[model samples]
Target: MKKLLAMLLVICSTASAEIQPEPIGRIQTLPDPYPPHWIVAVDVAFFHMNDGKLIVLDADSDDPAGRFKGMMNGTFIPVMYMAETRPEIYVLESFRARGHRGERTDVMTIYDKTTLAPIDEVVIPAKRVSAMPTEYYLQLVDDEKLALIYNFTPATTVSVVDLEKREFLGEVPIPGCSLIYPLAGRAFASLCGDGKLLTIQLDRNGKLVSSERTEAFFDADNDPLMEKPAIIDGIAYFPTFLGNVFPVDLSGSAPVIGESWSLVEGVEGGWRPGGIVLAQGDASGRLYVLMHPDGHDGTHKDPGSEVWVFDPQTKQRVDRIELALPAITMGLTNDDDPLLVTTNINLEVDVYNANSGEHLRTIGNFGQETVFLFHSDR
Candidate 1:
């Protein structure tokens, strides 16, 4: 009996051995890529819309002072929308101003990064309904091909384009969904005028093999902040306007929504949750959920918001950072960098230490005003 117990103990110990997955490195370049030393990409508000330009700011020059000074004054963009290689930037333009009267045509300009000059300009096709400014999110799946999501209703379609030849490979119809976010060889999209999330998969022949509804919303007509699903560690994090966060597991035979997280912890619960960013360091641990207190009136106007950070591992609310100004959008600087909140107040981006809610740096209207990307030089 004693000898049998010893063998069982040994078997249990071996079963407990943990197999760790590789950490995803800081996203440096896209599939086929080239990037400058500093300033990965800046999303700026151009032509009155969120259409921003990507400017390269490198101070490691013969004349550091001169190079630094030159950055303050925007440089001519080689690419409009920052992509993988030859095309570093793709700027989707909108001619008409919001609430402005009448129809208008627009052009999307592509630029090269090294030279900061225009490479190609294509006219964005008009939509049947009232048009709004949207980005043509492009992903270079491989060396020769790219997955492109053209933004515009009626004209909205996901297609594969030949990078070398700029040839239209083919377009796949995404009914009910208007926005397509391409990541990890699959596209996660949300139905237009609805909060339902859908998953689209493409086979080797570039044909969209299966399209399935991943998650349905609480309300059919409710606009759920309309943001891209954060895909991290093979798990897609979906934070809804209703203060719910879904961590979907993709490792299984079929992807399943593992856990539902509530950002604001209270008897009544949180609402209008936006800007959900994943925590760094300990893998499969914490996730930061930014909540906007726009009490269910359905109008998205909120005065001053608070970010409630939660630890998924512990399944608890970690901390809260009250923003003096109302946050328009939020992002991260480093893997461990604090939450970078962008406010419409001063159009400034403030960085807070993720854990302690300490203000690190307010990268004020230093570069771009809108949704900005913070990359670590470390």
Candidate 2:
């Protein structure tokens, strides 16, 4: 009887410890009913500058799917999304061991898409440019094989990283130039301070194969091109501050400067180009330019009240989109029915039909100030 009681007690103890699995505190993921097209907005809080975040929103529903914060070292840094490869996002940021006064460690952190967790990180030896955030600061080249990150410690240089090998190769000096535009193969073009284009060709090992400079293309001081250009089929359409469209051919070995044309014709009160995303290109080779009336000097960064769609082939304004709110940046999805998305100064994202220019919806009071808007389809 004593043995029977002991065995029964052991069984009861085991049964008590094995509690029934409850639905509470369990992990579950429902199907994503939203469309695949995504809009990545880098929100750099002007007031709370240290609390910057990369917010990814579904273009179809205007719902945020993920948010990445505290990775940018309390500064506004550029982040690139790699959709073609193993599905990861790359951020060019700095880290200091002993706070702001310590030696800075420039690194690129790769985050997983599903969990938004850091999967890999590679240290960049060269100091990266930490001025205003621009997409040209970091770009993936050769079908996502190499990542070329621009560095500017007052002197221009590019840090090359082999993404496939997951290693930093080296830095290439680009004197008297700023910004990067990836050309055919492993070559890239930079905008020179003296109104010229500098093209640098690199071998697989990140060594300089050839470097060339074009003639002074645009007036850098009077009418400069915006850092962000609309690239389509190895051609970059640069919009000048005074509403001029400049195209540069990057298909060949050397840079070819195409004819420059004005975006506005005989407008009343000085219509000029303005906004963070001054211009964007669609898959059909149409260029979308943001325009503001009564623009003056130092007004290049102002919000645009109108969006003009133009065809680069014909150089004509095909359609005009009257924005419901003034936009500081704009992006477009590349789906069958493309959506023109714009972020206003009020930190709200306005979605519109790309073809009809009809207002679709407004999303976000998410308590973040957005600086740049990028489309996943790009």
Kindly provide the TM-score of model 1 when superposed on the true structure, using C-alpha atoms.
0.63
Give the per-residue lDDT of model 2 (tens digit) for 1-378. 999999999999999999798787754322222244565567666555445666666656634434222122224355555445666678776766664547778888886655556678889974898766767888877778888999989888999999888899999999999988877788889999899889998889887888888889789999988878888677888999889989898776566889998898766768888888878877777889888998989999899998999988898999999999999988887665778888887878888888899998887765556656564534
Report the lDDT of model 2 for residue 72: 22
lDDT of each: 0.48, 0.77
lDDT string for model 1 (312-362, tens) is: 656677667776665655544333423443443466555555567766545
RMSD of each: 18.1, 6.5
